[model samples]
Target: MKRLLLERALYPLLGLAVIVVAWQLYTQLYAVSRIVLPSPSDIALASVRHFALLLAQTWPTLGATVLGFVIALVLGIPLAVCVANSRVLNLTLYPILVATQSVPKVAIAPIVLVWFGFGMESKLAIAFLVAFFPIVVDTATGLRSTPPGLLELARSLRASPWQVFSKVQMPAALPFVFSGAKVAITLAVIGAVIGEFVGSVDGLGNLLLAANSQLESPLAWAALIWLSALGIVLFAAVALVERLVVPWGHSGR
Candidate 1:
């Protein structure tokens, strides 16, 4: 366990530390303007100085991201099941999903803002839009990828469709569902930031933009770091859940 922790966590932290030290040295030796690039120390100081404000602004983004991700899972899994099970639905809905996905989220943000306003609703909507795709695609793939022999055996045993789905298919799909969830959660953060960038009065994204516009580079960088941290935390959460629910899948790795 200790070795695993060192390999997975400590090494990454050490690498990051090295990068930060190198960055600080470069800035000091060359006198890089703080406006163009704030040193790590400056960003750290800014984070500490405005920690309360940053924490306050983080809630909205976090709420939108988490809620949107949950919504994606709630809707996407069932949708994937329907599409995977029904050839007609797959033929009908899959193309529409693809078409909508092709349209840039940035382009749709303004319309979402108009519909949902500059509130958390807009952010949530945008997050849902971004996170929904991967969940559906990956889950459907998993369902289809279920070993034919297992499915045939279940059928031969006279297992009901629901029984086969709930027992055989869902278990096989767990890894894929979690994979999509990991991707969706990170994209949820991006989507929330996009909504905030387009129009919002709160969130870390707004804070970052305000700091940047006011030439408070350190504060902006701090917010950027916080955003990265938030994404990492969320991704880690999904991964932890995956490990718990699908232990056999990750045992070798």
Candidate 2:
């Protein structure tokens, strides 16, 4: 078990090291200009030089991602339960939900901005919109698939509806919920960045746009790196929560 886990951790680091080595070599061999693609070392320097500014910008983006993710969870799971339990709701609401996803988020980002204005509200709304669907779909599937044997056993015991749901259905659905959360967390980050790109005075996305406009390639790369790190961190956090919540399961480590 120790060896397996060690390999799991080491493999990704090995892959990253190979990529960095290749990237450094390519830049050196081609003598890549700083304007086009800055080296990893250049980006590291930029990150250090502007650490304070990056931290300042990171807060808003992180806030939006978190708020939006929470909203998705609050709204998605209960709706999933309702849809899973009620054929009428599933029929009426599912099509509309699917239809909304057909619209490109970027196209409607302007409309959301119009509705919520250029503030944190707009970012939160967009993040919620982006992260909501996966949870609803995954949780609904899980709820519907609760084992028939368990349901029969509970019913034979005269289990109350709430007892059955709280004890069996919800626990059974956790793996699925966590699956969606992993996906939604990444989407939340993207959604926040989109909100920042469309209109915002803060966030890594805004900082990125500003850097590119000024031809600050190193700064832009640094922001990009930070954004990628943010996504990975959020994803890992969700996975960790899953391990805590569903300790018996794999947690997809």
Q: Pick by lDDT: which candidate is best?
A: 1
**lDDT (0 to 1) per candidate:** 0.96, 0.93
Query: Local error of candidate 1 at 24, Å?
Result: 0.6
Could you give candidate 2's per-residue lDDT for residues 1-253 as a string of tens digits? 9999999999999999999989988988999998899888889999999999999999999999999999999999999999988999999999998898898887878899989988898888899999999999899998988999999999999999999999989998899999998999999999999999999889999999999999999999999999999999999999999999988768354
Error of 2 at 102 (Å): 1.3
Position 134, candidate 2: lDDT: 91
Q: Between which residue pairs do clashes occur in model 1?
A: none
* Window of ten residues with lowest summed lDDT in model 1: 244-253
lDDT of 2 at 251: 38
Which regions of candidate 2 deviate over 4 angstroms?
251-253
